[model samples]
Target: MKWMEKVEHMYDQFTVREQKILVTMVLVVVGFVFFMFAFFISDAFDERRERIRVLRETVTLLQKNRNLVQESRQAQASLELKAVQKPPMLQGHLDQIAKQYELSLNFTPQKPKDLGENQEYQVESVELKLHDAPIKNLMQFLDQIERGNYIMMITDIKLTTRRGQPDRMDPVLIVSSYYKRSAEELKALHDKAAEADKGKDKADMKESTKTTKDDL
Candidate 1:
């Protein structure tokens, strides 16, 4: 009430037009302050939301790494992986599985390639054609592949009804498998790295000697 009295006293000092102009100016200033506060709050919320999203994705990635990650050397010790002759070996394995499942199977394997120097395993893929297959049978086959000692991923699949036989389905499968680098390849990479390190050391020694001569 005392504040209101002060406000009224101040208001009485101005003419009608002046009072309206003063009120307009006050309203404009108050609106500007509120707008600025809302803008800052919205920006803070966006930043916090993005940070939370990144943290959640990081947690998920860590969980995945914990479950399945293996060093290439360790994988080599446990599993029989033929990086050089991958196609014949993979085809034989798949043929055995196909016969057991009583499904007609055909496979075409792509050339295996190095993922990267830091990556533990190289990538290889197989394209499969399954004729007159059922979903239940296909699920069983996929389950066996994943549960086995080998690390394999079914990257893609396409299914369609067999022509003239609507009851039967044809399925195409793309399977990606990981394997350790061959011993020869690993040795080559190691030698390359050793040469680089030697070169770097020589450069450092030369630079240091130059710096010492300059100081003298």
Candidate 2:
């Protein structure tokens, strides 16, 4: 407080030229501080503001998609239920479809792919190498496959004609099916099914034996 008063008294006692010089020095310092704030600090503040704006926009987009995300999860669970547990389980079913369409099937099934994201689920796919078939037969075969009881997807298909046999084209059809249970689990289930069948056969045999004695 006393230093402020001393500065005031000193400025009053200073000559005009000395006062002008002091004022200039004060103005220069003030200008330097203003430049620093406008160029450096303001720039930093602008970057911060822009980053915050982008984050707000991202949050808004995610909020808008919340319902869609929920719907997708529900749909995924239902689809998993319809997925096949093994590729071989569907081979006979596919043959029935081909027979219906009068189309011969030359299939090459790949090894089952382990989808580790779900402990109980896997993906099994087969590729059909077609030599030649009527256009109607081909369309019916594809339609039956897509509209099958199990949820299935055709990954790819490409047809090319041989130079000699322009009438016949070698078309490849890739079909993928999802497996609901792991291999180990399926094996256990299969053993149980076999035991049940064996028990049923034995019961039938015992019934036949009793009936033969009664008839005699």
**Candidate 2 clash pair list:** none
Which 10-residue span in candidate 1 carries the lowest summed lDDT? 80-89
**Candidate 1 segments exceeding 4 Å error:** 1-88, 163-167, 182-185, 189-216
Q: Write the per-residue lDDT of candidate 1 for residues 125-180, one digit (tens) a residue.
A: 88999988876777778766654555666889898987887666888988777766
TM-score to native of every candidate shown: 0.44, 0.59
Query: Stretches of candidate 2 above 4 Å error?
Result: 1-4, 12-15, 34-78, 84-88, 117-119, 162-168, 182-216
lDDT for each of the candidates?
0.78, 0.79
State the TM-score for model 2.
Answer: 0.59
Candidate 2 lDDT score at position 202: 100
Across residues 99-205, which tens digit of lDDT does each residue of candidate 2 receive? Answer: 99777888898887756544456677888877677666777788778664466778889877766765656678888776678567867766887999999999999
Best by TM-score: 2
